[model samples]
Target: MELKQVIEILNGNVLTPSANLGRQVKGGVGADLMSDVLSSTQPEAVLLTGLCNPQVVRTAVMADITAIVLVRGKHPPAETLQLAESEGVPIISTRYGMFEACGRLFQAGLPCLERPVNGE
Candidate 1:
């Protein structure tokens, strides 16, 4: 799914990186803890989180997530947005909660990533 598709699916507002709407999203992962996200998220996945902090962007960078969906209408601080912008990651906000946001993306055909081969 493209970032624009995610925005349309969640009725999300792009808080930053409006130019990144064309970027492709390969999957979605919903998590509140940055450590969990860093440990498990697949590259190019969309991160669905309610944690409104700069660390969210840092985690996204570590995980190589293409976009972030701020669930429950949560808004990150301006500094967070600035960090995301500098990192070239798009930040989107939605009124839906985490579960609903994940479900919406999943139902729209954005599947999660499978475990890596060979049990690396």
Candidate 2:
């Protein structure tokens, strides 16, 4: 789904307007643990999390995630937003919790990453 559609679905606020909202995200991965995100997320996926830190942006960059949605009405620090913008990653904030946000996206046809087969 397109990033614009995901934003609409989640009722999110665009923290970084410079991001490519037209880009398509193939799937999503909701996790607060950066390690799990790094290990599980797929290329072009949107990361849904409550972890509002610069590390989240760094992780997104390392994982090639194009967008991030901060759940549960949480907002990241200025530095985090700055880092995300510099990395060309869009940061979105949503009132929905992680589970609700994930469910909404899933219902809207945004699939989640599949678990590796026996840890690959």
Candidate 3:
């Protein structure tokens, strides 16, 4: 699925104006824990998390994740937004909870792409 489709499907708003809506989203990973995300995330997958923090963006960078979807209408602090912008990571906010957001993307043909911590 394309990043733009994710925004439309979830009724999301782009928090980062610099975000490229044309970026390809190969899969999805929903998690509140940054550690969990670092452990299981796949490159180019969209991250769905309710946690509104700068660390989320940092995690996305480290994991090579495509974009971020802030579920449950959560908004991060100013630093989070600034860091995301500096890092060139797109941040999107949606009123839908994590589960529903994931469902919408899954229904749209975006599979859940997660890796085992053990690299299995």
Candidate 4:
């Protein structure tokens, strides 16, 4: 799934790194706990979360996640946007909840790639 498709699926709007909306997403992961994301998120996965904090971007960086979809219409703080901007993780906002966002991506054929322990 392309980042543009995620925006279309969740009716999201790109708030930062607008140019990244066309990036390709190879998988998806839904998690609110930053620790869980760090443990489980895969490269190329579009992270779906309601956690509106800079740590979210930090985790996205560690996991190499390409895009972040803020679910339930939640938006991250400016600091988070700055972090994402610096790290090149595009941020999008959507009214859909976490489960709904994940389902939408899955229904759209975004495969759930297995998360290896090392995520190599």
Report lDDT (Cα) of residue 83, candidate 4. Answer: 85
Tens-place lDDT digits, model 3, residues 43-106: 9999999988889999999999899999999988999999999999999999999889999999
* Candidate 1 lDDT (Cα, 0 to 1): 0.88
Q: How many clashes in each candidate?
A: 0, 0, 0, 0
* Alpha-carbon TM-score of each model against the true structure: 0.92, 0.95, 0.95, 0.90
**What TM-score should be assigned to candidate 3?**
0.95
> Which lDDT tens digits does candidate 2 get at residues 5-107?
9999999999997978899999999989999888777888999999998999999999988799999989889999999988999999999999999999999
Over 2-119, each residue of candidate 4 has an lDDT whose tens digit, in order, gives 7888899899989895446778889998888888887776688888889889988888888888888899898778898888888888999999988888898899899875476754
Off by over 4 Å in 2: 117-120
Query: In terms of lDDT, which candidate is stronger, 2 or 4?
Result: 2
Error of 3 at 1 (Å): 1.6
Query: Which candidate order results from sorting by lDDT in descending order?
Result: 3, 2, 1, 4
For all predictions, the C-alpha RMSD in Å is: 2.2, 1.3, 1.3, 2.6
Clashes of 4: 0
| Residue 68 shift from truth in candidate 1, angstroms | 0.5
RMSD to the native, candidate 4? 2.6
Instruction: Say which prediction, candidate 1 or candidate 4, comes out ahead on lDDT.
Output: 1
**Model 1, range 1-120, lDDT digits (tens) per residue?**
889999999999999954479899899889898877877777999999898889999888888989889999988899999999998889999999999999998999999853344577
Task: Say which candidate scores most in lDDT.
Answer: 3
